[model samples]
Target: MTYVKDQSFKQDSLEISIAEPKDYFALLKPRVMYLVVLTALAGIMTAPGHVHGLIGFVSLLAIAVGAGASGALNMWYDADIDAIMTRTRTRPVPSGRITGDQALAFGLILSFASVFTLGLVANWLAASLLAFTIFFYAVIYTMWLKRWTPQNIVIGGAAGAFPPIVGCAAASGSITWDSVILFTIIFLWTPPHFWALAILKSQDYEEAGVPMMPNAKGLDRTRLEILIYSLLLAPVGVLPWLFGFASPVYGVLSIVSGLGFVALAWRVFQRRTGKPADSAAKGLFAYSILYLFLLFGVLVIETAGALILNRLG
Candidate 1:
């Protein structure tokens, strides 16, 4: 629950343990990595094609590693600011468990390994996408946008949006409208999800000197932005079905989940003026993770089911 911590005030029992390799892995943010893998797998599955099992496995591994590389690189770059933010202060780099040099080396090695493996096992197109995702996340998002703009997550969100496209290219050696829609769903969902966390964590951001939306715009305006994004997300979530890639099952599920997102957004909007703002924002932030995961989970299952049904029929 509390992660690894061994502390005592008696004698010199000073815990000399550095954040283990596992801590570095945690820096990768496994929960986010899982989403990356899942959506990528869904894209590979939903696409009309055949891929060798070993190659598919390698491709996914490469994407996951690239994602972890991005996380480590981000931790390296944001170490100073991370030390000031409650949410990020415990990261390996900031906690003195891992040094920035170690992180940079780890990220660089993983990035090259991932792209090379993906290229050999899958396609050059897939490999290129993975490379760009890493660069975008490491350089663009972490180094450039994070400290400079209120729209940091809005634009930096593109880093997280690339996996499905990477997976599509991995399988079919190209991109498609369906993959773009998959990218769009996550893209639209990112700002609201992150902004909610930012709202509750505004002081942390401000203290860290990161220009988060809430630190840039007032609380009321951020809440309004959350609501607006929620409204846009509803239509985007159901677009797969509308465009004929998914079934009515996904359509219904998307609508229901989107409505839940809206309800939480409404609560956040109403609670923006009080000390309750933090609670409201935290609730929305937690639910937003669930909402996105479930939406994608259902999409994968329903899409797979449709394929099986069509085969049987």
Candidate 2:
């Protein structure tokens, strides 16, 4: 459906008439938020200190809200490009279900509320990290890097990586090496994750005038970059075990998963030029999600077991 860009006073007044609950919810980008919550929870669970039950719940909720705020701001700013890209054209802002001004207001309100509430219920360090995360994803990555450079996702990945660090700070009231390792894992993992999708969506980005890696760099270079990052990601995945924060089981699982990740990435890299990179890219993309889930899942399990044992003792 083509949405008329009606920015007149009459249209602005009709904003409430066109809006719905789902439209607002779509602003949250719930799927992406889920991964953020998982990694953040993993960081909180694995930290050496503890948080009260209520406090932990509140921190996670605040972080989720902050992530939603970032998503809203991104959609508001990218409405023009989003309307051009097939994958994003139907989003609320681009589709005209929500006005950009309303979306902007919604995001700003949530951003401030999430940060201040987290600070009050958790700690200032965690709150500050969330505040920076919102700013980075919204202003730095979304506004500047996304339009200006091929390295957009690479640098923007830090915004996604901050959740775990914030979670660690919220739980322990400070940062730890373990949380930093988690941050590094996600940071390194982001390029391969998004680049695989970028390879498939290069045409969309091209039409939208966005400088995704697959578009700015050639497909061959993009594939090589994916492989290089995948190689880096493998070792970082095992850092938790190497640093003595995880059990041998977790180490073994991480190694196995990392190898699987590398194998899939290699398959993408080895595919003959233009023969069909999608299958391999899709495989790697799917596997990357599973690989992260497995890594963090093990952390959660081990931490839960330790907590149980401690209580029993």
Candidate 3:
């Protein structure tokens, strides 16, 4: 007996809650979009400029809407494979909560609305980038890369990595070293973070006919790549401090967290002796998300602290 904000289409439409905003929000994948919006805001906040509160709110909203649109489109396109993968089988499209056509229409309408609103409220450049991001994730990543090559996540990672840049562009209308650095950090971080999951979920993917790194390359090779990328991610994570953008707090946290990430990779690489080979990979996969969240969280807090210090000064 969930209530609908509006009428919804479902058997026992009474059994389904149409009025609750949560269900529709779930179709938008708000949890995933929250991370996207946070990272994007961090990039915008850390950059050397000021965004007005109203404009900033609209900008974030537009980016968020665009992200949701992308998720809907992704779910729409991947509904078939999603139905097969246990991890994704419960998604709105696959679980009978939302139809693929409904998702497609929802995504397209939101995509256009977000872009048009952003361009009207902010700038065309950012709006255009948002449009491209939605298309990139929905089409390039979900539709093509996910099924074609083991390098799927590697290339597909770019879709997720674009949000920060889009936020930066929304704020400043152009790219900067700082913005590009933020993009670089996320871009480089994506491969290893996802490959960890791929390693563990190789079977899930192979069964679904998706070519992830672990399936394309051997497990040992994938582990090596994860270690390598993690090493790169550690130093890149600290570029804010390297470029004098933040205080030493960021540098210290980045170094410590980065080291921890590398250590986790090492553990997975060497001590992978017990349980299914998937266990070690799964451990790395889960930890990698924590690592990135912590890494970015530190940067966001560090920047906010600096803003307060400057305000006091």
Candidate 4:
């Protein structure tokens, strides 16, 4: 009887000790990873050179791992602030599902592995960009800027924007004007996207001591900045067509979408002075997400169509 009880207790303990795969997956921030992968694919497709199927697959996989690693590290470092913010309190590290040390180790290992593997499979330029992206997000943005300045997202946006450039390098072994335009679009789009959320979550940032735009610069100023960025992003979206990479279909979609984005931002600016301003800000935030997805979706379709044409020819 005693032996059986001890055996049963040990079995229960073992079950409790085992961590689910999903918890590790959560550490990767899968939603953000999806965007990174899609944008990187767009970069690869838009480039003016060819990449082998197997090599491209490996490079994309490596890029994804690196992006996930950066998210993990950001979570690890921001666990304190994340715990305080309602939006992030349930994340793996802050929720006590994973310890900071575990997240840190996971991030570091993934970062090193992804960068090294990318270099082995692709060019050093792609790998170097990946390494810099990881460092920028993990250290520059998460550790220092997020807590220190309102412009954190503005400059740190570069980290997220680098995927297309990295993809271009992986595909062509060099970056070009087209990749730079892709980079510019994302970089400019980030502020308005995030600032809208900030307007909605000023209290969260204040509680977490994060110097988000609304909190640091006042709500009115943040709204103006959001409108400014939206206006800037409008023209950048039309550049791929002018540069001669995208088709007329992409051009039409981009122009219409950019106008819609600016109109939403204008609403956000106008309504920001009142009440919660929840409706306006939330509307912009939601539409901004769809805007990016649609823009990139068009790019993906165009690239696919071009590939089909090339094969047929």
Local distance difference test, each candidate:
0.87, 0.93, 0.82, 0.91
Give the per-residue lDDT of model 1 (tens digit) for 233-260.
9889898889988878888988898898
TM-scores of the candidates are: 0.91, 0.94, 0.90, 0.94
How do these models rank on lDDT, best leading?
2, 4, 1, 3
Worst 10 residues of 3 by lDDT: 13-22
Residue 163 displacement in candidate 3 (angstroms): 1.4
CA lDDT, candidate 3, residue 141: 88
- Look at candidate 1 and give me any clashing residue pairs: none
Model 2 spans with C-alpha error above 4 angstroms: 1-15, 273-275
Model 3 spans with C-alpha error above 4 angstroms: 1-20, 276-279
* lDDT, candidate 2, 1-313, per-residue tens: 9787875567454446478989999999999899989999998898776678789989999999999999999999999999999999999999888999989999999999999999999999999999999999999999999999999999999999999899999999889999999999999999999999999889999999999998898888999999999999999999999999999999999999999999999999988456466899989899999999899988988988999899899
lDDT of 4 by residue, 134-158 (tens): 9999999998899999999999999
Choose 2 or 3, whichever is better by lDDT: 2
Instruction: Give the CA lDDT, 0 to 100, for residue 192 in model 4.
Output: 97
Q: lDDT by residue for model 3 over 1-313, one digit each (tens)?
A: 9776875666564444232455467778887797888878876786567878689789989999999999988888998998988888988778877777778888999999999998988799999999999989999888887888877777878878887788888888876788778788888888888887777677888888887777777778888888888888889989878998767887898888888888888877775555755676677778777877876787778787778899899
Ranking by TM-score: 2, 4, 1, 3
**Model 1 alpha-carbon drift over 4 Å, by segment:** 1-19, 306-313
Q: Decide which is better by lDDT, 1 or 3.
A: 1
